[model samples]
Target: MKEKWESYPSSIRLLAIAAIIFSTGMACIWPLVTIYIHDYLGKPLTVAGFLLLLNQGAFLIGSVAGGMLFDRWGKMRTIILSSAGIIAMSTSLGFTDDFTLYTIFFLLNGLFYGTLSPVINALAVVLWPEGGRKGLNMIYVAQNAGVAAGSALGGVLASVSFAWTFFGNAITQVIVLVLFAVMLPRYVKSLALKPQSPEMPAQEAGKAEMLLSQPAPAKKVVWGALLMLCAGLLISWIVYVQWTTVLSAYMQSLGISLRQYSFLWTINGGLILFGQPLIAWVISRFARTLKAQMLLGSYVFVLSMLILSQTTSYTGFVAAMFVMTLGEMLVWPAVPAVAAEYTPEGQEGFIQGLVSGTGSAGRMLGPLLGAFIFQTFQAEGLLYIMAGLALLSVLFFALHSSFQKGSHRVPVQTAEKL
Candidate 1:
């Protein structure tokens, strides 16, 4: 196992570690935010909700800016600066007693986290180009693991004191900051000067062949595909986030306990971690191309929502969650991986940022949209609408993939590569 672990590239290993640490800290804070503001700080629930929305808005802006910086300001410098801000903001939150100061610190933390996310993803692509989607997938898995760990840890700490939870978030970030400062610069240097081996899979080689054989894609064609990808991600998240936002209330109305709803996420996190190898096999065998993976995932999402619309039993909800988790496993990472493929020479970071920012847009919109629908039409109407939006997302992905059909005039093997 040790030898197997070392066989992977150093950059991949380090990035995975950083993702787990950063996400764990993030999980610690986010799940407790509304509770802290309402119960401890004496704010209304609506104010807390609004603050969360603003925090997400800040993150959306930071994602775009971070991507541009990654392209122009240099990856190492951008990463270090973002990490510093994250550490400082989180640490400030630990000591903050005033609601206004806490809100400002919270927004800054979101901004820094948003900045950090895309940079890490872009770095995964650049540092391990040969690894293809595997690098991105690894980071995704690490993040889910962090969420599981941090949520459990945060809950325990919050039971003791909210201050401890804040401190815990800062402590994890401090470790991440130290790791970035000490180890990441070497990889950044290597990125500039190193000429590494091409350890890509045969499928990736074929994809490379297809790209090389074609004339440089017209800017319009490239943008068409990229914008479609962004649109797909945005719609997909808008529907997907319903599980977190509105579904909990829907389930409770049917008499499902809060613990049971929480357990659904526990199942999600568990499957994402332990079900990776099986999921990878399914992807390799059935969905060889990124397009296929995404479409299949989108269809699965539709199925989940359809089932959810009728599901009143806890067992039924559990089944739907299981299916939903499988779908997201395919869809989420593939978005960034696909975006990486269409990236221009110097705009890799920005493309990734664009993707992340678009997803943030979806997250920001999802709850409000779902709530409006639910208020007017109730649970069944909202679920069906979510399903329809998911299908629309599938359309965007299919249209995006269509633009690349010209480039994919290669042999079957080449077409199979993503």
Candidate 2:
């Protein structure tokens, strides 16, 4: 274990840290961008909504592309190129004034951002073949920490000047880009010489070698479950994404300042930092039956959204966000972890990419759904739609659990063969 942890090259470590910083800056823009478009760009909320959707759509494309590239070109190169792309896109956005042009840049930004998951995961596994889960979780903590910081900072910067927020993000991206370019090569080279751990049996090693020798077949069951999980996750995220998108407008409509709005994100981040470890520990204790935890978390998420919809004051809103984030802390990490578990050996990159791509698709759909509902009926209507979706997700998950239970059987014959 000591050797496994120590095997990670300093370059990979530096790159991971840089990635976290870049992600933090990227996240900072989410909550503020809606207001920036409405007040500064003179665009309609629907147009802003479309721009947000476009960003995630671009990310979906990028993720698919990134996964394929990672499999072929290697992980370090992908990270370097992606980070550079983000830097260029973000910097260009600062200079552009046209709403259409800004939307285009945002799409490019999403594409670059999409490269992160596969590359990061691949690097983690390569660096610590025996400690994939622990390493990945650590990386996740870093990533989420950056996100929380970015969300909070974006709100504060938006209050001072929206331009400053964009510019600051651009600068942070550039620094990370430079840092990654210098550091990644060194890390990759250093880690390349480490021997594969003894934990991998010769047969499993042969299987991996065989996989690398030929193209992978797409598994139907895996794909089907992925689709279903994506649908459920999309509805769940729409509820959360609202906090950064429509919810900001809704809160402002109720007379909340941007500063107060930003602070809520800080609270959300703090809660995640504190709550995620506990949630992870709890999940570990019941790792054999994650479906139940998933269902419970989804139900809690629904209740929290319902509570959020009823809030008339800032305090009430904050309280509701707390409850909602608690559910989120429980659900978010589990989704990816479960995806990783179900992924076939030697197809980690493809499966992780699919998971991220599906997530991007959900993100694209969430805001559009939220904005349309908000526009048609009211914010209350938006919450109702989310609540209904969440409840439906709960039902689907429950049915899925039952189906798995009924189908599950001890494969005595297969066990004997093994």
Candidate 3:
């Protein structure tokens, strides 16, 4: 276990730390923003929902722009520019009571925030080409840790004064900027200028050999797979967002307390931190191929939704959540790593950005769709819908098939294979 943690390069390790800190600050506002805007500010839920959509919409644009900048200029330059812009914008909009000002601030913040996230993921690709899945999984763990930390703290501060939540977000973003400023030239810049090695861990050596043995498929085939994967990822996230939006009302309808509902996320985050390394190791040991790992996760995701559709007891919900967390941990990291693998080397930042953009697309749409379903038909209805969507996602992933050895590999005489 210790060795597994130690396997990632220092760049990825620092990137994970940066992700945790960034997510911590983000969580400070994300989980509470709707409640504060709707309940405290006396806006309708619809208004709150639209604002959330606007933020994500802006974020999607930022993600695309950021990725292009990363590829064209360089990672360090793009990261510094994006981070500094976000900091400056957020600071200027400090502690505003005006709803219009708040809305604009959120839109701008989302754009800059969107840019930063993909760049960070791109950095992971640059730092650990061989350990793609492990690098992303570690970053995912750090992000969840930040979520757990910030959620708990945000609740406390929001109760005292809402201003503190924004203050917390701004201050932490400043710290992120500082870290990047200090570390970029020495770490990220050096990695970028040096050529990347295609080495794999011993356990994955056979699969790597097989990939090299085969004839490279057409570039069109590689791109088609990535596009489909992006669509599948978007669908998965739409269902995932239910846990934040409509799930609260679902729990309350079942006579579950808010505290109990919150505890489910606590369990979700705790399990990821402790269980992710072992899960990553298992994937490396057995799954090896990205397709197999994603298939395993997609099936688990379907199972989780099916469980949610029927369970009335608290224990059943907890069990379902555990399964759901496992599914996400398996699927999310694998997607980006595979995207990196399929990407045509120099365009990695753009590819990862496209992946992040799809995620933002889901976040933008999920809440609106989820809220409508929840209010119209309630928990059972919503769960059923989610289960069906997840099933489709599973099918979407099955389209291109596995990255297994033997037939999966093209003959090396033809060209290099993924």
Candidate 4:
């Protein structure tokens, strides 16, 4: 772990830290949105639901818009503007009491929040072009850490006053905004002055570098590959989110306590934070290619679904959760890393935005779909159907791989370490 941390450039490390801080702030709002709307504002559950939908939809639009702006407006400027927007909206939310005004601020907050992710991802890829999945993986870990931290902190803050949660969120973002202003401008200037080479020698190249060594695919082909990759990602997220939605209710129906169900997430977060070294070692040794690692993850997802279908005991559910977490670790980071590899020279932010937006869309759709299936067919049926959905994602990935024409194998000795 120390070796990997040291291997990353200072820029990549800063980006990961920024992700942690930024995500921590955002995470504080997500868990409380429904409760705040329904309980405090005297709104109906359906109204809360509709507002959540609007927030997500706005975020999706913001993601794409942010990407376009990144390509046009420059990276540092785009990031600062996005951060400013988040700060403004979140600060307004802290003081606003009217539900109508609160809803407007929430949607704007989602919009500005959406812009940050793609730019950060595109920045990571550019900052550490030779790091393969490691750079993005580091960001992923940091975001999860932020989520865990923010969730716990938010719970405590809400106990005192709900206003505190928004204030706390805004405070974190303000720190991030300052950090970006002070630390990131130099990095972005360096990027402008020192453009990345599109190709590298095979003897020292990693997956990202090796892909860069190939002839740049035409714009249309790049979009096609991205679409295929996004299709798989969309399905993968849909299958993965069941653990929080239908699967949660199903476990409680089976007499598992809510505390135990919640503990499963605790286990999930703990393992992700602590288990990376071993997972990194395994990947470095065996699944060296991005495609291979993601395929392995997809299989693991299938295994998790199968395990869920047959299990009623708490122990069985725990085992399934473990498997599911492992699967996500492989697939989630790899998708964007792979997309980074194929991104056109001027379109990095746009490509990453599409990937982020697609995942957002899946997240928005997953609960509704999962709930419908669980209601219509029950637990076992939902499991089998989701397993099939996971399998379908595999086919999408395979199709994506096929789209990479003229690809060739490079020697193992040439590859960079994970």
Q: Each candidate's lDDT (Cα)?
A: 0.85, 0.69, 0.79, 0.84
- Distance from true location, Cα of 209 in model 4, Å: 19
TM-score for each predicted model, relative to the true structure: 0.90, 0.76, 0.86, 0.90
List clashing residue pairs in candidate 4: none
lDDT of 2 by residue, 308-388 (tens): 778779998888888787777665655655555455544456656776787687677776777788999898888878888
**Residue 111 of model 1, lDDT score:** 94
Candidate 4, 1-418: lDDT as tens digits: 6787788899988888888998889889888888999899989988987888788888888899888888777777788889889889998998988998998999999999999778888888767777769889999999999999999989998999999899999899889888878776687667666634556665555766665566644556666777788999999999998997788888888999989998999999998999897678868886889988888788889899999999899999999999999889999999999888866556667878888899889888988999899889988999999999999888888788777664222212221110
How should the candidates be ordered by lDDT, best one leading?
A: 1, 4, 3, 2
lDDT of 3 by residue, 193-296 (tens): 56324665765877766767655666666667776788789988998888877887778888999999989988888888888666867677767788888878
Best by lDDT: 1
Looking at candidate 3, what is the lDDT of residue 51? Answer: 87
Model 1: per-residue Cα lDDT at residue 313 = 93
Model 1: residues with Cα > 4 Å off, grouped in runs? 1-7, 196-217, 405-418
Question: What is the overall TM-score of model 1 with all chains considered together?
Answer: 0.90
Indicate the worst ten consecutive residues by lDDT in candidate 2. Answer: 409-418
Worst 10 residues of 1 by lDDT: 409-418
